[model samples]
Target: MVDLRLERVCEEASKLFISKGYARTQINYIANAAGISVGSIYTLFTSKKAIFDFVLKCIIDGNYMGNNMALPIKESDFASLDGEILNVCKELSENFEKHILDGDDSYDFKQMISDVFDIISRYGVAFLIFQSNGSDSGVLYAYYVQFRKLFCENVEKYVYNFMEKGEIRRCEFPEHHARLILETLSWWGMHVKYDAFETNTGISQDVSKNVAMDALLHAYTI
Candidate 1:
């Protein structure tokens, strides 16, 4: 079991690290934010790097491992498109499209945006921390790249399914489209939420989602 105080310290440190970056954030800042003494922080973590490592561990343990983003597509699944895997994919595609599309002409753009935002918001702080520390060499960076690649691949598969169903127009570069959508959602749902220097636009999540989805749908849909 995790100690309550230690958990509190990690939570506070995560926020500070997100907002201020690792180099800029200090133990004193985290200690104050956690409502604990500097000594208490030291007792729990030998150094700031230790606290960051713990926070990264917590994020991994929180199931942000990207395994749940999409079903694994086996080589055999592609060879036998009529296999059970394709059947499962079709079912998932139907369920996913149900919430986003109405016929082939209309879409619930706002709802799709909301769903994406909600999913990304769960990892907003952790993503911000990763972005801030992206230049560093470590296991965290490896996990970050791995998660991003997995998500992009998942989106690519979804886009390909939509194309096959004639629900969306075929793109010259489907993978690029997938990356764009994912990066856009990451920016709005995570980066903008915790930016330290940018002046807040005071834009609510709904409005941001509407605007973003509108532009993306315009580009991707017929």
Candidate 2:
């Protein structure tokens, strides 16, 4: 029972941090939002910083309650690498499509970029924390490194699938192409929330993706 309250406190604390920023968020704020006592929070977390650290770690580690941040997984039924990659891309594409199309009224392409940026800005707190604390905690640093490496692997798989399907122009350096796409997305993630740029929201996502596909096809598809 205490553990559950602690968990709720952590969740409320995270939302408050994202909504209000960390330094401004107080123990009373968390206690009120979580419907728990300030002393109880102290029992589970040594300090507000500790609670923030846990919240940041949880958000970046793919446990953020409001964000569907799961990594693309290959189905057990798909035995082949190509099949797995296709399934993963399809899933990713569907997610992006829904956001780009069926999201809240303002969720156009520009808003999509904004959303990506929002996710990055929120997650960056944890990443920054990890970077600062890396030397002190070998295990935590190693875990973050592992996730970063997996992110790269997933990018490569997606790029390879595009090449295989003739959706993109083939690059002599496929890895470089993969890196470019990943970096582009990361850039959007990092800067889009606070920096709203003039994106092509006038175009539909399908048309936008088609344009990207056409550009790649013209550049690499033989």
Candidates in order: C-alpha RMSD to true structure: 11.2, 13.1
The Cα RMSD in angstroms, rounded to one decimal, for candidate 2 relative to the true structure is: 13.1
**11: Cα error in model 1, Å:** 5.7
Candidate 1: tens digits of C-alpha lDDT, residues 1-222: 335666687678887787778888888999998898988767666677767765655553463232232222122322332232234334544554553244543433344445666657665666678777876524555555655565556566667766776767888988887788777876777666567356366877777666677777777776
Q: Candidate 2 at 123: error in angstroms?
A: 4.1
- The local lDDT score (0 to 100) that residue 176 gets in candidate 1 is 88
Which residue pairs overlap in candidate 2's backbone? 169-216, 169-220, 169-221, 170-220
- Each candidate structure's TM-score, on Cα atoms with residue i matched to residue i, is 0.57, 0.41
Model 2 whole-model lDDT (C-alpha atoms): 0.52
Candidate 2 vs. true structure, TM-score: 0.41
lDDT of 2 by residue, 31-74 (tens): 88999887766665666766655564455445433433222211
Count of backbone clashes, every candidate in sequence? 0, 4
Off by over 4 Å in 1: 1-12, 32-46, 57-116, 134-137, 196-211
Worst 10 residues of 2 by lDDT: 69-78
